[model samples]
Target: MIVEDSAVVRHLLAHLVSRDPRLELAAAVASAEEALAEIERVRPDVISMDIRLPGLDGLEATRRIMAEHPTPIVVIADAVEERGLRISMNALRAGALTVVEKPLGPGREGWEAVAEAICTQLFIMSQVPVIRQRGIGGMGAGPGRAASARAGVPPFSRPSMVGIAASTGGPPAIARVLGALPADFAAPILLVQHMGASFMEGFAAWLDGLVAPRVLIARDGMRPQPGQVHVAPGNRHLSLTPAGLLRVTDTPPVGGQRPAADVLFDSMARALGPRAMGILLTGMGEDGARGLVAINSAGGITLAEDETTAIVYGMPAAAVRLGGVSASLPLDGIGPRLLRAIGGTLEATGGQ
Candidate 1:
């Protein structure tokens, strides 16, 4: 299923989805109201939603679906801006799972690769349990909500900053963890994800909607602050100094990426030491392994996302193998675990 106001885009997306043997078009609609009807009637396996629509916008529709039907949604939007970006980001926050910009065609932007990416995200998010948090009051119950209230985890406090890394299935995974955090979260989050340059700006803009913290692409020498997220640009390596300054470089790619997790992890180890908490989530490589080892050795907390929920399980699994991961946890537990880890409590989850 695809929801877009443009008839041409609807046709293009339908054709692209049909090309995949693993998927079939359930329906295509131009309005959110019509989309809701089609979704209930068809019970689609997945939905590719646009931020703009004829009547009810895509983001509002996403909120309604999540609050009601709770199905998997993947956002396909134009570039991020005030309203458009807000709509797309809100969709993710409302449990849309992932956000990707529209391809560069007249209808669907004509980018075949973008269509493939959307399909891949939908397929992957579908397999993961759609554990939507009803409200903060639901914490400490159910699998998804219980993870949020696990005892002995430390509450977030004043930490100079936080550093995180992910790859492959990173965007949605990162959003899930970040969305759970409170708006007043008292530390800046530095992020590294192996993604293309074409999408980095949009990615940051998209993230700003899902979390309370402001999200921006990192600028060299920027000082870390609470309630903000700095993302490593596609062609840059991001690091931190002992004094808490961001270091973004155009250095050669390490571990198959310019914004390699290893570089960020190692830098955090030297800079923040025990004050740091490193999180390794779903992905396709071992870039963060050694750096996590350094983090753990320096008394910082390290966490790996558990395989059962990961789209690829490569990076977090690799960090675990390196004997650096202090705890291995399911994706939903990551935010609460991080809060605990940063607060100086590290009870075993028996997860890995």
Candidate 2:
């Protein structure tokens, strides 16, 4: 299904979908109202949504659709406009699977390639199974149970930094995890979220306002302060040196992702060892699985979001299969478990 206001772009998107052998056009509508009217009737496997619409913008539309029908949605956003990018990020928070650069019509240069990429992304996203908002299930594991002799890790390990890897349904999950942390959470977070290059700047800016900690695009040679979050810049690998400074590298893409999660995790393993903590959240692939193993081998704490709460369990499942995780937890349990592994910081700071 396609929900777009522009007739020209809508027609082109429809054409793009029809032409792709891997995809099929379910419906095409000019407004969110039209989309809502048609969604239940058509029952599309996926939806291509426009962030900006005549009435009832994509963010609200996403929330309603996820609540009512629970279908996968991919937001197509204008990369040139900061506000559109912001709305796109908000749409992700509202339950859209992912956001992509809006394609101009075929008259524009490089339109064909961009359109192909968009279609491929749409098809790949369509395969992700969606569910009605369950509001963070499976909190069975708590801070008390975080320490496990069965998992082969110490009961307490003071981590100096945290590295996270996420993709597909990541934005909102990351938001929930970070928002659950206290004001003085005390770890510099290095995050690698798979997204289009154009969305990275706006993603960081939007996240900074939503979470207590400071969030910014990672920079080379920068030292991360406590409670600061550094997101890997687009098209670059974010790694840390043994000296404890961030490095944004131009090295070739690892596992087809420029700012691969493995790069960040591997670096953390080498630099911080037992003092490093890694979290593999909801995502569609195995990008961060090896990195988690690297950290586990170095005696660091590795946590993975269990399949029970993960939007998609690919990354976390991969880690579990590779023997990388010290504890497999639900989304609601991760923040508290991290705090627990810190040993005494939360009690000292008067935090829950």
Candidate 3:
């Protein structure tokens, strides 16, 4: 299903969907109101949503749909407009699966590539299994508290730095973990999230507002500071030098992902060794699995988000299957576990 206000874009998407025999055009509506009304009848496996609409905007529509009837949604956003990028991030936070930039003019150069990319994204998103919204309170302080209470003697030493990698349903998960940490957290944090180029600035800005620590896009030659979070920019791979300074490279995508989790995790394992910590969160594919193994082999603490809380279990599952995870935890528990790890209070019990 496609929910777009522009008739031309709607028709274009419909035609594109028709061309792919694997996809079915359940419905295409012009406004959010119309989409809300028609979605129940269509029961689409996935939806391509536009940010701007006549009645309710795409973000709100996405929130409502996820609350009432959970389904994977991909935001088709205008790449040039800053507001479009901002709303697209909000849509992801509201439970939409991913965002794709709207193709430029249909007849312009590179149109075929853009069209093919959109089709590919749609097909991939349709296969993802979506869960119902459990509300904000359900996400905070439950199993994590129980686990923390049972912790015995601490095994892992305090880490000098922390490296995290996520994709797909990562925005909210990142926000949840960061929000739980204090402003005075002692370890410098590095993050790599797979997102479109147009959305990077908006995502960093949005994340800054949500977390206590300073959140900024990573820059070459910058040294990460404690209590601050550095996010890899789009189209660049973020890594660390042996001197512990940040390095952004134009290296080719690893496992088809620029700013791949493997790059950052491998760098941390080599640079900080036992002094580093690696976290693999909700995402698609096995990009970070080998890096997590590297971290484990280096005697560093490696964690993967538990399958129950992960929006997509692909990345973490790969790490767990490879025997890379030192501990597998729920979303809310991860921050608390990290806090305990840094505070030297967590037990030595191996992977759960």
Candidate 4:
């Protein structure tokens, strides 16, 4: 399904969906109401929706769809406009799976590449099965779990700090993982997302509403505390001090990211070592791979979202290929699994 107010953009998006052998357009409409109706009736595997529309708009439609259908939805928006960009991100928070900038047109030079990106996301979304098990699933008897146990990674001596890194379709992806955690969660979570300077604050705020943890933009020099979720601000690197202090830096972009995941993971390896639980979610680059290896070397437990659930498999796949990921679980398993990793019981866990 494609939902856009402009006739030209709608037609172009429909054309893009038609090009993929695995994807078929169920409907294309000008308003969110009609889009919602079509979704209720068609129950598509994926949706390419616009951020702005005649009624209800895309974000609201996405929120309602998630609350009702819980199907994967991809939002389409213009990249150049600030408001459009913000709304597109908000749509992600509303449970949309990914966001792709609308293509220029069939006549435009880069249209084929744009269409390819859309098809790729749709195919990925179609393949990810909804996660069912809570806490830890099977006792895989893998070396990873045995190593974590030997290191005393769980049942901590003190409050553990959580570190995560992501990019590309990270906003909604991370939210889905974190939203499963409780507000009074016993640990502190720090997130490093590869996004521009303008979007982090709003993203953090949007996540706070969805999760029990108090999500805040990380500040330099703050001491680690439980029940708080801190997100690395845009255009700055976030690292943990050996003293367990939150250190924010305007360092050179590592892996082409100012708020690079590698820097954060390296710092966690040095500071918290085996006491930290490091997670690498979905994204398009190899930003977190080396750092995850560092964390694994430090005896800390590391997890990567499995390829099945990732919006873009690049970052997590890199970590997996590097042999840094301790356990590769689906997105829905992350929150509950993290709780179990911290010694919480499966019966007590709950999240949408």
Tens digit of per-residue lDDT, candidate 2, span 1-352: 9999999889989999989899988899999999999998999999999999988999889888988999989999988798898889888877798988888877788788779878988898889898885433323443323333243345545787899889988988898788776656667889999988888999999889888878999999999876778999988999999999999998999988889999999999999988889999999889999999999998898989878777789999899899998888777777766666654244564444
For residues 140-216, write the lDDT of model 1, one tens digit per residue: 31242222234554432223457789875577678878876765566778999876565688778778766767899
User: lDDT of candidate 2 vs native?
Assistant: 0.85
After superposing candidate 2, which stretches have Cα over 4 Å from the reference? 107-110, 134-156, 343-352
Model 3 residue 33 distance off true place after TM-score fit, in angstroms: 1.0
lDDT for predicted candidate 1 compared with the true structure: 0.74
- Candidates' RMSD to native: 6.7, 3.3, 4.3, 7.6
lDDT of 4 by residue, 1-352 (tens): 7778899888877877787788888888888888777777887777778887877988888777777777777777776666777787777655676666678877687677677877787777765443322212222323332323343334433327789889866886687777777666767788998764655776676677777778899999998666788899978999999998999999789877889999999998899887777899988779999999998887787888777666678899899889997778777767777776664422333311
Residue 34, model 1: Cα distance from true site in angstroms = 2.8
Q: What lDDT does each candidate get?
A: 0.74, 0.85, 0.86, 0.75
Ordering by lDDT: 3, 2, 4, 1
lDDT of 3 by residue, 243-309 (tens): 9999999989999999899999999999999888999999999999999999888989888888778
Question: Against the correct fold, how does model 1 do in TM-score?
Answer: 0.71
Q: Higher-TM-score candidate among 1 and 4?
A: 1
Runs with alpha carbons beyond 4 Å of true place in candidate 1: 106-112, 132-161, 166-188, 193-215, 223-228, 241-244, 250-258, 270-275, 281-290, 304-322, 328-352
Looking at candidate 3, what is the lDDT of residue 237? 97
What's the CA error at residue 189 for candidate 3, in Å?
A: 0.9
lDDT of 4: 0.75
